[model samples]
Target: MSRQTNKLTATAVKSAKPTDKPVKMADGGGLYLEVRASGGKYWRMKYRFAGKEKLLAIGTYPEISLADARKAREKAKERLSEGVDPSMAKQLERKLGQQVAANTFQLVAQEWLERVHQHDVVPDHYQRNRRRLERDAFPVLGKRPLSEISAAELLACLRRIEDRGHVETAHRVKALCGQVFRYGISTGRAERDPTPDLRGALRPHRSQHFAALTEPSAVAELLRAIDGYGGQPVTIAALQIAPMVFTRPGELRQARWSDIDLDNALWSFTASKTDQPLLVPLPSQAVAILRDLYGLTGRSEYVFPGARSHKRPMSNVAIKAALDRMGFKGQMTAHGFRAMARTILAERLGYPPEYIEQQLAHAVRDSNGRAYNRTQFLEQRREMLQRWADYLDELRQAHPSSSQSSAQ
Candidate 1:
């Protein structure tokens, strides 16, 4: 019932057309050469398996000769006899290839970010994590497969950051790698996390504290030096308010005009360190200085707009430079104002530590065991700020010679 012919040659296959039709290969048993309208020749096998006729492609002509095509066709027949579908087997191969590709670190990291975003990771947290990936991890192992990442490679990546004097950042990078690796493991893309062995690997860092002027006389000298500052009005006002308010240099420099209320005598700003909105009750002197600066820079949004760029605020270094110019480089920094206020307000003025702490916006436990509010110690803070300002003025007027002569 089968039409058998002599072995098909390349010329015969090329000259054949759909009209000429296909001929069964004498060597192939049931396999035949198919000639199409496009003059393309293909080898196909026709067989009965499980009471059904099935056709399977061996390969094209020339590339796979008649003999080789028949050999492939015979192998497929053997698989079919075992109840295996060749089409499904090919599909499984393709799926395995895709799985291998998706197991790459770059692919897994992208998938991790997608999953994290869907779970509502806060924007700040997302930004921080993304920065770590871009700065610390991506350059080395981004394109590598997750399973290819060994413990040595991970330790090397973290050590690069450690070499830059950021032990804390190196530790954080190790943590992020662990997170990404765990994500890979959960998705069956990676077999093991490489960061667990990195504990105690980094060198210890020396602890350093900010230099602060704590003595009242030294603080008074620093204030007098700031008062005599011949800098720009914004810089001078920032220096003036730095000791009075004792806020962090960053918070003071980034203060916006909209955050200040001259009429209510309040300087309200979102504290950068705590990420909380704070209401600082301005004393009469602080209010007067703000009024003068407001009239000068009221049109701009920032209280201390940069000289070169109005859109940006003054730099924190500018305040420190002002202190350096006054020859107090090592003795006081812009942050020293907080120490000055804490010392003078608590010891010299005999103000309640709670009231002074609240004024400083330092974290404190309330009477109800709850956190302090933005308006905590409102009345007491108002009184304390005024008293602190008056005390500074009293110190400014008191002279050593006059006080000694009066005592005599």
Candidate 2:
């Protein structure tokens, strides 16, 4: 401790030179000022708490006047005497100040993604939310703090998405922002969310359904045309089996060589659409196609390997394009094969509805009914597939001067 220089006035304080003895100024209470040996003066407060003495620096001399320094030091001492650790108290105050400064919409949005979005959301919702955030929210409010984001700024972002003819997407983005803001509020990062004000700001969007073929005869004609496609062998095989099996285009295209057992007449595949392992019993015609395809593609992993990249499966558009080449563009789609099979197997073939649904890999209501394993009707399906193949053969036989005849 140094001697106090309470006698020094403001003028004397300015003139004070470097000395061993420090000049002291009273800042009220136990706080005092000391002029250092280097002529720079600083505020120092001394207090005893919890059986230990603690020294705290309030501020530098004229930069923080004696009066203010003394007041600050006294406040700290008062807190210390009240069973509070002033050092811990100061650290908490600093942390709170930093949080307040960082409490922007952007910060809260990121926090929401890191905390809630990644864990609580389903895989599809997680991916959709991430895409929405990247395409809409990040471009505008990503760098802006949550507290600084006004309703006008948020509206501008939503309007931008709406202008691109994505009104529904814009509405979803706004709703997601509201969720992020609420998360921020719960986590003590924001006081209020501004996204609620944008409810009616965006234009409503009209819903559109996918165009699909549903008629039985039309579907049969489409299948006949696909069977006559004289494109690549892999394309022909895919088109031939796609209708017969009626699986999703992805599942059909991504069929692997290892999953098929020709001797057992089974086509096992991990279905991407259902996320379940499926076992499809191969019909005699399907087995013949696979046997031919195996001789060509068995060396690789994929049943239909891409021409440009053997490691990857053939493109989804390949089958549809082959169908187009066969002149059945609008009359059929890749998915139309499902309608064809469902209608024919249920109506013309007179197969049970449950068997048809099970073969289609559709979820059935009756669990107590015979298991829906596609292989259950293996023998019947083989017969049915051969009959369908024979029908297609007859169609080609009838069209003597067909485009496929020239190609073949």
Candidate 3:
């Protein structure tokens, strides 16, 4: 005979007091409420799976209620009919959920940053990437599983940045997220990278060229202005040497005295962006300036040590502020010295393009597709820099009004 079901009532369940022993009220189809002597009530469903008897804990009293317990019993019956074990299925679902929680986007991204990204870039570059992710990407997507993050969801995150009128920042954050997703794929935390699907999703941003001066006459005027800068002796020397060597401002300010061979007229160091060795052929003028500055700051590690402490490099804005004070605020900038050299060397002085680019520490390659070694064209570059420095001296000696008037 079949077992009787629906033997419990809500009125009886609420009023039924706990006794010295536990009591169970049957609600049919193997569902029942067990009231313990401790006054705790729980719902359980008894069943037989694969010829073995088992019990499934549905929930607790008042919380599960009589109606909810009956519904759970029907669902468990459906699972049995399909040859699925309800208890085992529930356990598997819970384990999968735990795995998802463990492999969240933020956790995987952090691993990528520490193990991979940090080694590939400079510390400052790595820190900037980390800050971009933390400030924009983390709060919204951090807790979500890497594999579960869809391309549409990623686009939504980037759209927020674009909505704030930071189109360029949005583009950068998108690329940053792409790196994280690719890392996640390699680590098996993600199935695929979704960024490729977002090619046209972001607003295109125009590249903002750094303010630079390319005209020789204008550059001459700026050079003359630099000559008149009444800054500290250390800063004056940097400004003077800046045009002669034309290195990136960061590399110039952070230059270590040990990296230069003043005797050989060469400055050799690893390029920050490419992490490749670069050899800068210092002209006699550049070497002379360094020698004079050495008397004041030669003992310090950084050639242009900060004003407050000799331990740190000068502030990045120090040269910019100096230029502003010299009344070349919009007309020229510290980095303009490089553009000035590149243009004048190729056009005015008639130096080869490859030599100019190589001197710029760019990744210029040979005819056979090999990157030029740091020492490539050493002799030619040495001559070019000397002539370039001498030409600058001529320009500086020429009246500032003379070049501007000649341009007219």
Tens-digit lDDT string for candidate 2 (115-202):
7886664344566788899879988988777767789999999889989988889888988999988897787767788877766777
Instruction: List the lowest-lDDT window of 10 residues for candidate 3.
Output: 399-408
| Every model's TM-score | 0.65, 0.58, 0.81
- Which residue window of length 10 is worst by lDDT in model 2? 399-408
Go through the candidates in order and give each one's C-alpha lDDT.
Answer: 0.76, 0.71, 0.88
Q: Find the 10 residues in a row with the least total lDDT in model 1.
A: 399-408
Model 2 / residue 364 / CA error / Å: 2.0
Candidate 2 pairs with clashing backbones = 5-24, 104-145, 104-146, 105-145, 105-146
- What does candidate 3's lDDT look like per residue over 210-266, in tens digits? 677877677787787777778998888889999898888888998999999999988
Among residues 3 or more apart in sequence or in different chains, the pairs in candidate 1 whose N, CA or C atoms overlap within 3 Å are none
Candidate 1: tens digits of C-alpha lDDT, residues 1-408: 775533666566656656555444434456788766565777887776677877777778778876677677667767788888765665787898888787877678768877863344433456677788888888888878898899898889888999888987888778878888999999889999988877677776565567888765565566677778898888898888777778877778878888888899888876554556678998999988888888888888888888787787887589889899998989888887888888878776788888887777677777788868788888788888888887776654556334322222
What residue runs in model 3 are displaced by over 4 Å at the alpha carbon?
1-48, 52-77, 232-234, 291-301, 305-312, 401-408
Q: What is the lDDT of residue 268 in candidate 3?
A: 91
